[model samples]
Target chain A: MTYLIEGRDGPWELVVGLEVHAQVISQSKLFSGASASYGGEPNTHVSLVDAGFPGMLPVINRECVAQAVRTGLGLKARVNLESRFDRKNYFYADLPTGYQISQFTHPIIGEGAIEIELADGSTRMIGITRLHLEQDAGKSMHDQDPARSFIDLNRAGVALMEIVSEPDIRTPEEAGAYLRKLRMILRYLGTCDGNMEEGSMRADVNVSVRKAGEPFRTRCEIKNVNSIRYVMQAIEVEAVRQVEIWEGGGSVDQETRLFDPARSETRSLRSKEDAHDYRYFPDPDLLPLVIEEAWVQDLAAHLPELPDAKCQRFQDEYGIPRYDAGVLVAEQATADFYETVARGRDPRLAANWVIGDFFAALNRTGRTIQDSPISADALGGMLDLITDGTINGKIAKDVFEEMLESGESAAEIVERKGLRQVTDTGAIDAAVQAVLDKNPDKLAEYRSGKDKLFGFFVGQVMKAMAGKGNPALVNEALKKVL
Target chain B: MSLDPATVRRIARLARIGIDESDLPALQRELNGILGWIEQLNEVDIDNVEPMVGTGHAALRMREDVVTDGDAREAVLSNAPDTAGPYYTVPKVVE
Candidate 1:
């Protein structure tokens, strides 16, 4: 469904496209041998080329290039064998080179698409315009001192893959979904960490509004929205702001604006005069980036099974519901954990335990799949006990709780607690006879066709056995006796 | 394309070049002359031809991923216009 915001005139639909800057995960920076790790001492990761020394030249890092290709393949985009880097000439305190090396006319990754699953379980394809590699600017801290600004060149010359998207997003929800899906893909490929909080990944949101059927109007770029929630809020707020401008008989100027998350508003960062004529030209130092066709195929072949394929396989192979499959495949680790527990076990039961009590326990303890107290193998072991009738379902819950507390194996816990189910029919028959003797009036009524009393007799029998009686065996014994 | 004095002045400002107002006319003429000479290439019919971005067909050479350089804080900061405690200091920036 198309999301619309009601205005004085009518409902207006928003058009959004996002440019996400994901820092490529590599050991070194793009053109230098400085550490690419985050939170280093200021300027500690700087090389002569990164710090823009006189006559210093840049050398591309091969692993960074491979990372970009891996990301492109994960997005299902076409990778160009040959792409050129250009110099975007500009000046800032942080940009010591007076120009940024970026891809302007040609990029490594061409047109592609990502499937974003919406909250309604409906999927939509968002077009990816291109992905280009670029160098990052250094950090300029304004508040480090009262009278002097501080410059940290650690982030300078870091490889950044700027993924641009076509304006296919019509709602903030779609935008958020697209970002999340993109982040998940990048993380799965291990190309980028997708850490928006640490500034590894960020989006510049472009938003415009018009009547439902009208053509796209001018868009205002919301710069450097760090979080997905802020991106969504910025789009809605900016779209409403645009609608007001259009209705008020004032033209919206095309320019960059900053999303003030605190105020929930966007303010102009620069007017037309501040618009840059980057004077982009091919970089003279670096040659055109080219890769062998076989290299791309190799990268594609080695890619881990992505989320969509894993989700579909889970439903088809395990007979799990679509919702359960989606939940399991949201993270690679969770999916792997589920597979370990589900293999050679009752899949539906495994799904129930993992998605139900297991997830609840993790949430209650503020732990993730990696740090969960209940290991996959341990859960599988518990399932094995349930299958073999060593314990009943109710007793298994107690065993699971004990396992959570003591980090012991399910068998060990069951043994220590002596919570084994009584599967012997001879013993179960005596327990059933004792229950019937105690509940004489209920048994009489049950024989008189008061079928509701059957449950009362079964509960009494299980309780008489200290909840150790196999439910199925107890049921059988009671039926035969009655 | 022809360059006018105003356009030249704007370009100079954008490039952060300090050009005297009196030099605008001369700079405009020189810039236009260069552009006119470059415009001569438009006379050639190059249809179906790939635009060449560089002179060489060599692919970009890549270096191994390793942190072999840096940690020369004193050397790296040697050329800084102003420095304080391994940091490059500038006049207070408001934004």
Candidate 2:
């Protein structure tokens, strides 16, 4: 990680924070009846409220509030029984209303902590300052034509959970980990899909540099980084740039900047505004949000096991290594798939096949675990065959390739392909005798204590049986003859 | 805070406004008035009150681990400004 603007004369450290915008998973928009589904017609989801037509007042969506509470609980934060919506006054071509309805003084979710894992398998806790809900602004397009600025209102009035974090992160890796852990928790709590690429989730990274133990320095907010790789790069570039500025007897200004993916650099957009600059005032039309303690308690009770807890549980129950469990449980789909295969079969074996051979097949076919050619039950069947000695471990590969090629059950493919492991002792003995009779020189090598030649004899037996001979049976028959 | 000419100019630049130096004093007064009104919130006893992000109080909804996407390129690029046969088009570079 190098400085974007480097001229070193003094020391500086980066003080980073994040304001993550996550879309609420709901059927409708924040204030309107329009559908909140993505990939719809450009503006087909727009409503009168979203368009900011005259005399439109916002009505609180109960589902959206509940989602916020669930998120607060998942983050181990305090849930406010009383919260208010304020008007953050601003003017933009995309914002239909001159002011945006957001939370300023009273955010719904309060202080919390997220445990982020570093690259070296160490963990650190990042502080979550607050989580507030607000309406998303429309997108303004400037590249379409020279004179026209097109505004897409579909996003306007959509609900967003702006999770603000404390300036506790130091390195770019910590920021990336914080984002990943936060996304995992959100998805586990069923609050957000955490799909950054879909514009459903985004982060505004604030980075600055100061002396390591000095009070926090002025920082710049990098707006709307939509991917983990870009977020990390933005922090590194911004931190080094601040360091160089301070080292050069200059000052770091608090401003808003945007990261350019093409050049891998951040550019200034404007000076970052403080809360006072937004001129936030309680909304005159809507009243304070008030939820009963009993309802919030119920939501907390029904919360699913979060990522950290589930990862540990998977390791304990499945007898798999922690790293393997971590990989599987990091994604709910992969975890569920592993559980399906591990239900009755040997848990360790199931994990090995899923993570090893199964993942390889998925990678080869350019498909995800969810789209793999072998279903959990089909793979489970293959494992059962291995455990029952119906097919040896070596033969399972053949069955796996056949399953991918023919899309048939492992057992059916094994039967049709005659891949059954040959366990007949008399047949194996006769095959070994015939091979040994013809290859007398090889037999003499085995008798002379050249035991490595035994593998050659076993290979000949498997070939005599056209590669279907049970390896265990072949080993036993070769031992008897020797 | 007195609205210094330079500070006012900086604010104007941030808000994407073009303001003459002479009008800085008046604009500063107007902004202060608004900020003063907002200052009223500081008096509210909200030290223990929980901040609410949105109006709805429903829990987050989640779907099963499923992939509901197929990356339909035509469907996504249908709304782009300029596309060249399944790809977004941009200005020529290195000309």
Candidate 3:
């Protein structure tokens, strides 16, 4: 394994714990009925509750609670039956309330484990320390004006799920894997959309590198990693810097830092803020969230199969390879589409088409799986045409493009364009004979063990027939002639 | 956790609060009092009790190896201080 702490000596080890702030997947803000949509008119999504006005009290959104519970269930963490929001006292221009309402002593979820797949195809489980519900502070826009800092209250009181992890990660790969897994889980749970660029899912990485078997050192918290790639980059860069500092006989200070994505470097922000300094005490006005075991069970019952389970089942049930299963089940929408398209069809074929051509089309058109021009049924219809030999794979592509452009089915496209596979043996032999008669030199190459040129012959025959000839029959007749 | 004068000053600076020098003794006493109250957790044996991670049910989310919205270069860099086409610019960060 590469030295996790790059600049250090004396068998140093990286102890990485992540504090991931995921914006809860909800229609509105945490305490108010304001829209939580991103990139809306600046500060337009603010209510009195978000502004921290004198009379406004926090009214917890039940839908946000449901989303949090759903996320916890997905993580296999312990959902506290009684969790309460606490006031995290602080002073900032962005924090209009001068305090953030967050879960402190009584958090909603407890210990859980995340199975992260390594680059080697093996897996490791990272322990989830806690996941807390908190309201997000608004963004402090310093660049909005030359001489002033603007507060975008649109993010104020937005629900945030802070998923804290134990320092179980030992390598940068593991840390990266853990973060990606967490983001994937949040996205699947629909608790968070995991849009790191929009500041929806950010990470505060707690990194320290100590000698192997040594107790963890005072770790620095690198904050506001806005993208998964940036998070991993920050981890690698910071860990190496800490290790180098330690090796040079300097002490690692426990402070918060910021990652500059453009420069790919980490810089100190401020001293780390511990819980005690925040003066955390239960919010006096809001009552404790008294959830029952029955409620939790009901939520669990409604929980969809999470990533790991779905990946395994897809592998076993559909005979898809682990990599394909893992990919297919990464997103709930994509996985569902794969399942729908794979049903009663060749699983590998469905996966290839979905993950390959379908994905390319989606990307080219700037569409998501949810908002594709071709539905799962239409995709399945296209696959059926290929499987039943009604159209060759190449012909299916032409039909697929037609379907995308005209919003028609494979049958319609094949009929309209005369692109159906030519399965008639007599027609296929005639086309093959014509190609052979024209390409005696290539035929000689084929007879003399240059079998590769046989594909050229097949192509020539197809081109002569306007690509309407059945490829399988041509291959059969060509082999008989050889 | 008693807030001495120096500690009081540090906390004030950390919280970004301006405090009079003469008020140091009083602020220290109040902060110490608060820390002491919060220290009540020391009495309870949380030795093996894992810190709370999240609320609700426990499971992990994952996604397939697919890229979504990779072509948002212009839409993304639009919020930068200065941009040279697709990149965000700052005072040359590297000396």
**lDDT per residue as tens, model 3, A1-482:** 44444342456677888889989877777777777767666656676667665777666777777788888888888888778778999777667778899989889888998989888888888999888889998766556445455555667777899999988887878888888888888877778888887788888888888876777788888877777777778888887788788778889887888898888889887545432377777776566676768878898898778888899899899998999988888788999999999999999999999988898999999999988999999999999989888888888888888888989988888888788778888888888888889988888888899879988988898898888777777788888987
Q: Please, what are the lDDT tens digits per residue for candidate 1 over residues A47-73?
A: 999888989999999999999999999
Candidate 1 residue A211 C-alpha distance from true site, Å: 0.9
Sorted into a CAPRI-style docking class, model 2 comes out as incorrect
Residue A316, candidate 3: how far off, in angstroms? 3.2
Task: Assess every candidate by TM-score.
Answer: 0.93, 0.82, 0.81
Error of 3 at A199 (Å): 1.2
> How would you order the candidates by TM-score, starting with the best?
1, 2, 3
Question: Looking at model 1, what is the TM-score of chain A?
Answer: 0.94
Best-to-worst order by lDDT is 1, 2, 3
For candidate 3, what's the TM-score of chain A, rounded to 2 decimals?
0.90
Candidate achieving higher TM-score, 2 or 3: 2
Candidate 1 has which clashing residue pairs, if any? none
RMSD, one per candidate, in order: 2.5, 7.1, 8.8
TM-score for chain B considered on its own, for each of the candidates: 0.80, 0.55, 0.54
Q: What is the interface RMSD of each candidate, in Å?
A: 1.3, 10.7, 13.1
The candidate that achieves the highest DockQ relative to the unseen native structure: 1
lDDT of 2 by residue, A1-482 (tens): 32233346444556789999999998777776666777665555666666666787677677788899999999999898877788997767667677889998888889999998877788888999999989998766666656556556667777899999999887888889899999998998888999999888999998877664678778788999999999999888777777767776789777788899898888878534432377678887777777789999999999998888888988888788988888788878888899999998899999898889998899899988768878988889889999999898878988888888888998898888788888888888989999989899888878998989988998899889888788988999889888
True contacts kept of each: 0.78, 0.00, 0.02
The reply for model 2, stretches above 4 Å from the true place, is A1-14, A271-276, A434-460, B1-95
